[model samples]
Target: MAQQALPVRTARLGRALGPEPTSVSGVVLLLPGGEESSVRRPSPMMATASVRALGRRLARTGRADGLVAHVVHYRYRGWNGGEAHLAQDASWAADEAVRRYGDVTVCLLGYDMGARAALRSAGHEAVNSVVALAPWLPEQDVATPAEPVRQLAGRRVLIVHGTNDERNDPELSFRLAARAKKANRDVCRFEVHSDGHALYQHRHEVHALTEDFVLGALCGRGFSRPVEDALQAPPPLGLRMPLATGFGRSLRR
Candidate 1:
């Protein structure tokens, strides 16, 4: 099998329709926003870029050792990161990833509007898990970047956003948190302090913390010893959910 040049994953608009299954314990595809990082990088960047970096890093880290990770790059539009655009990207990635990776527990990861798009894709593929960091879901009539927060019922969703983020306030994240809880989905939220819109802005502790969450969530239930230890003994477990939840600030999950 020829090695993939970049973190490329299977994708098609809306639904998937290809095959040549590769087996694994789980599969994750990272989707970055339609920014210059995506257009310029032989690979993508920004929130989407960060996820791609995380995907590649995780793959190199213990997370990818026993799992499958691919970074899906889609041409979503607008600064806000709306539904129509995200949905198209998610569908394409989900279909393609599922086709190639088979039914191994699947997860679509993203951040900000990219997170919104991942949820939309999850709804379509009935994806097992969704890791939406700094997901932006505003109230109705607010003309949110994404049109209705994609229903996350029966899905495992992890929502993370920064407390002092200027673009999307804590209120917006709260609105999303409440909706996820109401849906009775296996969902959790984490807030990062001293963090802004960019994940890179966060400290190494934040990255390590986030990597733990991403690994745990994607690793599925039956985790190995090193994976479990790495996940718990880090910034994620150390973070206080209440404080971050109160203001939408800590990165604990």
Candidate 2:
């Protein structure tokens, strides 16, 4: 039988994450990479694609007892505001996720510009974990996030970036992850030998990893799979990575 194309439901994104927690106890918010021109609009197709693949890979985690997995479409950050725009969007998404989902945990999944946006959203209270795919962080390049996220000290962040990212050096992802770790002990980075700036080359591997990690979070260490295996990255340097305090040290904001 032919598989049905996942339906694209246009749902409002602001306020109330809605009420009701699925068995998995979480949801994924897909944000757009920043807008540089008319070209920077949110890619519903790509967002949907990520959600489709991730939602399936995440199936065993939430669906064990028929839990519903919602793939959210975050508000678009139309030109201007740079990192600050991303930072604010992230917070709004978190607030909305909690309101709608109530007590369920929230895991943010963002790529490219969206990835940076997801990272900014990390400091919010309800976000249990963040899946930052090729994210940019707050630093000289971008301003420190709004007061709230800047204060997040214990949130969990996961970063995945390809060795061949076109827009920026892939090393940027590691740097951001390192900054996040320095910011909070729970951050980790996974480097994938993916192609281009897209998620085309390593679908199955990525999907498997997402399934394991997200499940591991909600199940609270009871996942059949070991968390060590899920990371699939270099050994975490334990929590003392030097913060990026130089190179572009700004005098004032």
Candidate 3:
């Protein structure tokens, strides 16, 4: 007789960073980057500080509108190939948000490998939008399948990439964004000039853009001119718009 397969168990390891679930109208799930392949359980430190900071900023910006943020802690410290363990964790987080909030909208915000996971999991019923920062898109080859965009049909999508990133290829992300935009006109891509994988040079602008997109998608807030133009513009233009400096400061004015 064949041996029985044991069921895999995953832990729920994340905390809400704003209004209580019952009181919130929307959720932003933050996913941090990881390695290409590893099954080791993720440590607390594995949650990138950049992702945490962005989550806090988003929570503060959307506080009045009842938008809470949750940083999703992946079960593993890597993408784990075809298994897509990180994406599975993100999807579970989205489902958990719906279960806790009872019909509230969800936005997935992720960086690097986490961005890949966010894009992969945006098909979740609770997800209304996705923000991918320096996403790690797989190289198009016979051995690897292209990431699917059909799941993004009705959701808003934003891809922010650093031109100087040495890790993930910005061109790959641009290609994916173009494909997604073809299917869903709401998709847009922003290029952060002279920045690296961490996007530290334009961190504030990136965060601001994310806040604007997430708020607009979940709270009915209006988008800034550049964002609006990008969304409304035709291919190549919308897919290659630049992220201007002082975006966060300008928003305050």
> Local error of candidate 2 at 148, Å?
11
Which is the better candidate, 1 or 2, if ranked by lDDT? Answer: 1
Candidate 3 TM-score, true structure as reference: 0.94
lDDT of 2 by residue, 1-253 (tens): 9986533433345222223333435666655565532224356666455455565445444565333445555444342454355556667766766786577677767766667667666767777777766554333435444323344356666666666777656665665555555556656655556445665576555555555556556545432222343233343542212212121123121
lDDT of 1 by residue, 188-246 (tens): 66567667776445545445544565566666434333333432333333122421212
Kindly report which residue stretches of model 3 are placed more than 4 angstroms away from their true locations once superposed: 1-9, 19-22
Comparing 2 and 3 by lDDT, which wins? 3
- TM per candidate comes to 0.67, 0.68, 0.94
Model 1 TM-score on a 0 to 1 scale: 0.67
For candidate 3, write residues 197-233 as lDDT tens digits: 9999988889889988998988888888888899999
Off by over 4 Å in 2: 1-11, 14-24, 32-34, 37-43, 59-61, 65-68, 77-79, 136-152, 221-253
Worst 10 residues of 1 by lDDT: 12-21
lDDT of 2 at 167: 67
Highest-lDDT candidate: 3
